[model samples]
Target: MGKTPAELSIPAASISTEIPDIPVSIPSQLLERRPDIAVAERQVAAANAQIGIAKAAYFPTVNLSATNGFQTGTLSNLFTTAARYWALGPAAFALPLFDAGARGAQMAASIDAFDASVAAYRQTVLTGFQEVEDQLAALRILEQETEIQNKAVALAQEALKLTSNQFQAGTIGYLEVMTAQVVALDNQKAAIALLGQRLDASVLLIKALGGGWQASEIPNRDKIGGKTKWSQFLPIPIR
Candidate 1:
């Protein structure tokens, strides 16, 4: 049976808890998810695998081959040990000293793929930043709006109650009471809708940031810069 997503995932305990928790300054918790980070990481691994495949093309391939044959003038000779001849030897080596740009094409393709992956990773990071910023801004605005709406609802509800009492006292008609009630309901609904929007925006921001991929866990710039060959294959900027 195949491993489930949770089973296949890196253990949470292996990750450092030194990374700070996401702050709840804004209503959205979306950036905390970091879905894009995980995607970029996977892309980096795939690009590295591709690079390995490309590098293999530059190395000489060696193979061992063996053969056993039996020649018999009679059916009885087929089962005789003397009738069998066995041979074993290293197979031929056809090293590609040069191809009509085949190796060059492969190298170029691999490099291009690496470059593309880097770009994609950068874009994902930028997108994450943008989402967080936008969501934070939206959250702030929505919070303010919600507060205003709540006040409006409260005021409308008080007005409706007052109008109701006045109608019962025969100082106002039923229509006035109905109008106030409708206004209060509308304000309450608007507040609820704004609250929902804030929640949605938070979720979106979390997804953009690459859910659970903590920025603090990223290796230092110096360490990333020191790496020569394999590290270059990483999709995201290791720093």
Candidate 2:
């Protein structure tokens, strides 16, 4: 750690100095917190919608037509009641039966895709939970270790002070004083490193919690398709 310029530094930010406990409903609540999980879930939704779209092809296509116009022997009489005429009709067809096999294949592919997405969503959830657990455990252990290191630094400083006093009094050799000084310096440096580890663990824990994102913040799957406006469908708070 001493030889490394790569450091973790977060200004004006801190969490509890102790390890955090996992929520009671980690499995259920994790879905809303993790953006990765949300992405996988949305993919599943999109794939499901594709299945519906593929199935809709099996239904007959209905076409409706209407025409209304006025015709007269002369332009002056074009708007007359005798020239008024209107016609309307409905038409439908399901004649392309040969394409049924292709449609079926497409539907099956969509279903396979949905299944894959679902599997991915579940994997994301599991990974999210594991990361949270890992960071929490690391944070807890680091907190305890930091406290121990602080005590060690304090004790080493006291020892160094005593050694210096003995050296000044000619009761101990200079080598003893140097040893005590080195021990104190190393312990102090290790304490600083422990503090840094705790800070880094906090950052990882925050990421595992999805950076304060909520499931409710996710947009409705329907609004994400076709001509739907994103802002109208998904309201996200800035900042």
Off by over 4 Å in 2: 1-31, 77-85, 212-239
Tens digit per residue, CA lDDT, model 1, 1-239: 49885577653342122212356543333342455555675687678678889988988987779999997899988978989998998687768887898987898898889889988977877777787778668767877887888899889989998999999999988899889978987987787787678778667655555453345544443433344566566967554
Pairs that collide, model 2: none
Residue 236 Cα positional deviation in candidate 2, in Å, after optimal superposition = 26
User: Where is the poorest 10-residue window by lDDT in model 1?
Assistant: 12-21
